[model samples]
Target: MKMHLWSEFIAVIKKEVVPALGCTEPISVALAAAIAAQKLSGKVQKIAVCVSPNLMKNGMGVGVPGTGMVGLPIAAAVGAIAGDPTAGLEVLKRITPKDVIQAKALLNCDSVSVNVADVSYTLYAKVTVSSGIDFITVTIADSHTQVLSIEENGVSTYIAPQFCSKKPQSYDPFKDIVVKDLYDFAVNIPISYISFIEQAQTLNEALSIEGLTENYGLQVGMTFQRNIERGLLSHGLLTDVIMHTSAAADARMDGAMKTAMSNSGSGNQGITATVPVVVAAAYLGVGKDKTLRALVFSHLVAIYIKSQQHKLSALCGASTAAMGAAAAITFLLGGNYQQISHSLSSMIADIAGIICDGAKPSCALKVSSAAGAAVKAALLALDGMHASGDDGIVTNDVDQSIQNLCALVNGSMMQTDVQILDIMINK
Candidate 1:
């Protein structure tokens, strides 16, 4: 790869892969509220938060970190009270017990109101904080943490040109990336440039341990381990992958005060992409360099696939991240590019249409299922078995098959997204 291309790839990875606390949907809300709070001079008396439908859907039931509370109201209240906007997606990292109390009190008083906004973007958050007669507004749109506008006292203070024009240029750094390019980059790229990928292993592994040790969310990982101890499941690579990945999700979805190395704005997706590959690398006795390379492959594949869809979608992101894990596992198993492609195809064929209801404790179950399916797909690929082009969305070309999956999620599942949100809201 050319030095320029390598530099671009590294930059994209750095931007996409970073630490996040709690579910990103709620974090985005909190971040916006925090920014609005920063602009206020007096103590905040009220807050009005509006978000896109996708954001509303995902943030509805997920736990807010350090608050022991679920949904957007508490997230907004805590953010307005104690969140640090400078921390970006990790905005709630500074939330303390006192902050949680204040947030809960604010909720009890009905000082914070959350509603779905009429917005075209998949990711959007607008938070307005009031202190007596003065108010400040902060808006984040397009991507999580991308603040598009800020206003104070009903006056525009700052507005992104793209926000005004409403014709934001699509800047996809991975636009030219294909499966072959990802493989070549993973194997041939200099170690020094991509070595930082190891942080994904470090951060996500800690969350996995935390989940197993404590009863967080569904305790999916702990349950799996207990099942293995009871001789119901084998103690092996597949079990390890499922347990670690699910455990990480369990902690993340349940609002454990730990940072997850998020990919494409999702901690669960990051866990699904990293834990399986890390477990496989350890099981295969791979060294740091090879493990780092495989981790990069897995993350890059997930980022590339997700770049084609909305940031938040009706389709379960774990399935896409699991496809990345399957590719990495295939690479670790000494399978070539063809086999890696086959693994991705197998994954898409099996779990391409799992609808995302919301981000909550049950997400751990979906994460575990995706991880197990990833291992199965990798094994099938290693044995020279794969889903044919005739299978549902699988295509002869791996890249084309990925595009087909994206089309289904982004286009065909549009109504599915709305209906799922309706069901959740009405229920």
Candidate 2:
């Protein structure tokens, strides 16, 4: 029996699965700046960016698109100079070299300052753009692009609600949902209703192709490709999935001038969840109908796991997202729901405690690593192997196991975020 409305399911996925340029943290900073710029009457002369520790941690070392710079300041400046506010996460998509030059000039003048916010929200970015006499502040919280409020000169201004409906609607899609619900939806939902998911392939695969072909940071994907050519690495679904998934991360983390279809506000998470299934289905010669169903299952499963955890934590989202791929790969491998449950449990057992130091070129390595484990875990699940109930965080119930993992991340690992950020800042 379907326990949730298909409308509810579509709304959740559409809201979360969207396109983002560059790393989401920096791009979010840019979006906030662009919003401020859009509301300003004069040229932007100063910018003040206050973000939560998690935001700073992720945005600090990652590349900003088209600038060859790595940090929030350049992203903010470029966003102010050239970003389009209505474009949401793609605010920096249209940035040009001329815009980069102007942003650098603004930075040289010491016109931009980024500080850690005093707030407690895990995903928060507040950008204040000024034209000397007047300024606008745009704040996004909880979600990457969700604008909590817009203010001009310390007074709240009216901005159309981006995600709100004319009628108040509760959007707790995961409140009572489980993996079984995801399976049912993926299997029973009409293909036309979920075909929009194919765009994840269209957007993410381009990033992989660019990352493999170009000398993006670390070249993790290209490295796998090279090894395969020389017989150093066996070329197959698993290796190819890892290569394709990591390549997208390499391009995204290196600020390759392309957009990624982000999942749960992280582009690498989207790539990890999408490319593995896409590459696997292609390698296995799966049909479009089955592949699309698997894609929906993969992405929704990723979203479901993420919903159980903090928006950002010491927990590497790549692992959680890869669990989704694990479930999908099991489905593609002709495993039943019980095998899928084993795959999820196996993934939790395999990567229950991966840390997210921050977003960087090495993130591709993590995505690559997790994608491989997901594939391996799925195969093992097919063979009736999984984490024992007595295992650290695994349990007889998959849902309970996921919550245990979240408990660890949202509980003790928060301090890990602080320690990691401390080391990063001090170093």
Candidate 3:
């Protein structure tokens, strides 16, 4: 692979995968609040935030890290009170119990409000924090941490250049690429060039261990372990994959303080993309370089597919992330590029319709299901069983298969997002 192409691939990975402290929607809200609070004088007296409908939907039910709470109000309040603006997505990391108390008090006093913003971007947040008469506003849009503008007392202070970014659509580096480009890059690239990618394993696995050892969320991952000890569930590669993958999701969705190496702005998607590949590499006894290669392949593929969709969609992100896992697992199984493509098609065929109701404890179940399907999809592809064009969405061309999924969600099923959010808010 050429160095320029490698640079592009690395650019996408660097932008997409990073450490996030909580479900990204709430974390982004906290980040906005933190940035806004930083520009204000004295103690924070009030916080008002407007987030996109998609963000509102996801943040409504998910846990906010270390606060033992769910939703964006507390996140914004705590952020304004104690969050670190420099921490970016990990803005809520330094929050103390006292901060939680103060945040909850702000909520009690009705000093914080989170409303669905009528924003042009699908993923957007506008946060305003007031300290008596001193106030500041911060707007984040297009991607988490992409601060669009900052204003103090109605005077503009900063605006992001958004160098490569255009309107209504994100910049697309992979527009001319396909699965083969990712494959060649992962396989042919020097191992030294991509060794830093290993941090994903270190970070996500910590959450997995935390989830399994302690009680968090639904305990979906821990339950599998107990079932195995009871001889109800067999101890094998699949179980190992599920235990690790779902455990991470369990801890993350439940608002564990540990950061997850998120892909495409979602912690669950990160867990889905990372854990299965890690477990499968260990199960196969692959070398460090090989494991890293598979990791890059899986992550980039997930990023590629995920970047095509509305950042927050009713289409479950785990579906695309797991497809990446399926591809990497097949590659580890010593399958050729054709089989890797087949693995993706098979994954799409099996897990295509998994709707994302919202982000919460139950998301662990979804990631686990998608992880299992990934392994199964890889195995079927290794056995030369590809989903042909005759199937519903799975097509002869892998790229078109991906387009089919994107088109379905971004077009006809867009109302699915509206209805889902309406039901969630109403409920």
Candidate 4:
């Protein structure tokens, strides 16, 4: 029964935790536009896009997959011109050079303007399109790709928030994975089932090395790796794992064409969680079976931690990923379930409130530092040195500890979210 439950859990996680084509914010914009455009059912002559400051700020600096452009205008334009809503987060995957040209034309016509919405929601985007004879407006809010309302001409063809009663839900592949179930899947799943984990290794390791050669993100991972050359840090599994994990963030944020397997809609989270374990496996010369288990632990733990926080929180998603990385590293270092919980607890206490400013090349450094801290936390746990409940936010029970983290991000951090966005906009 336990094995069956775990298998089912892993299935759900694998389905939810997959690759996303672009940065989630602009993709949400394009997705809303595509739906509205499809509803128009005619030639799209004009398109207008309105977005919240948070969405605009994030979408402003990140790359739209397969297109070299950044920001909401192009993403909105492409959505109106060529995007398919059915593609989900990868909505703009089919964009072509012709589509890019057409999108630019739409922008040149002064059709896209980003403005703050009166609503105080963390996630929001509204797209309105006008064809020759028809006009449609679509609104996405509170969650990425949540189309709250839709109208065509004067008719409300789709009334979502009222008639439709579901909150905007993200693609959560790890929704059902419990810690024990993940452990079982790691220990018993066929090696073939997790061969994809190796790709995380290849892609991320390349990025870490590239980061050292060039300026990538905070250069935290590369800087640490370089310490080995200077004899400041020892050459070992920890160094190797951090290097590989951070390198991928460097590449992805710096606009590398290589694809990364994303988790809960962010590629950096996927890299931070998976690459470190993969590097550890390589450095320690671990067998495929053990390696697969460690990778699953890392990935599933990251997914679980992400579930605790609202997808968009005052905190950066990396903090959650770092917790996941820390747990995975604990397992790699021969820590059992108890120690895994300890590492997670330590991570929760330490990095729970790190805010997400935006996705950028500099994110690599943050990822590296987080991964390094995760390693330390895990090592400490393996030695039976865990954060005491009396100190900080650490709790006696692991699940309750995570809930405490969720409270901080979801319940207590609203002001912090607004303030961060305000500062970014002012800067």
Q: Candidate 1 — worst ten consecutive residues by lDDT sum?
A: 1-10
Q: Relative to the true structure, how large is the alpha-carbon lDDT of every model? A: 0.91, 0.91, 0.91, 0.74
- Deviation from native of the Cα of residue 240 in model 2, angstroms: 0.7
lDDT of 4 by residue, 1-427 (tens): 2565555556755754666555678888989989988888678787777777778767777766555666777788888888988977767767778888888887888866666676666688888888878899998886676678888896777766543665566554445545655666676777777766665555555655666676654566677778888998987766776776787787677544455667766777877877777777677677877876777767777777777677566777777877877877788778888888888888877777677888766777677777777888888998998886876777887777877887888876878877878888778
TM-score of each: 0.97, 0.96, 0.96, 0.83
Model 3, 140-242: lDDT tens digits are 9888888999999999988886633564565567968888899999999898888988999999889999999989999999999999999999978889998
* Model number with the top lDDT: 1
lDDT of 4 at 206: 62
Compute the lDDT of residue 402 as modeled in candidate 3: 93
Residue pairs with colliding backbones in model 2 are: none
Residues 275-350 of candidate 2 have per-residue lDDT tens digits of 9999999988999999999988999999988887878889999999999999999999999999998999999999
The clash tally of candidate 1 reads 0
RMSD of each: 1.4, 2.3, 1.9, 3.9
Score candidate 3 by TM-score against the native: 0.96
Which candidate, 1 or 4, would have the higher lDDT against the true structure?
1
Candidate 2 TM-score, C-alpha based:
0.96
**1 or 4, greater by TM-score:** 1
lDDT of 4 at 379: 84
lDDT of 2: 0.91
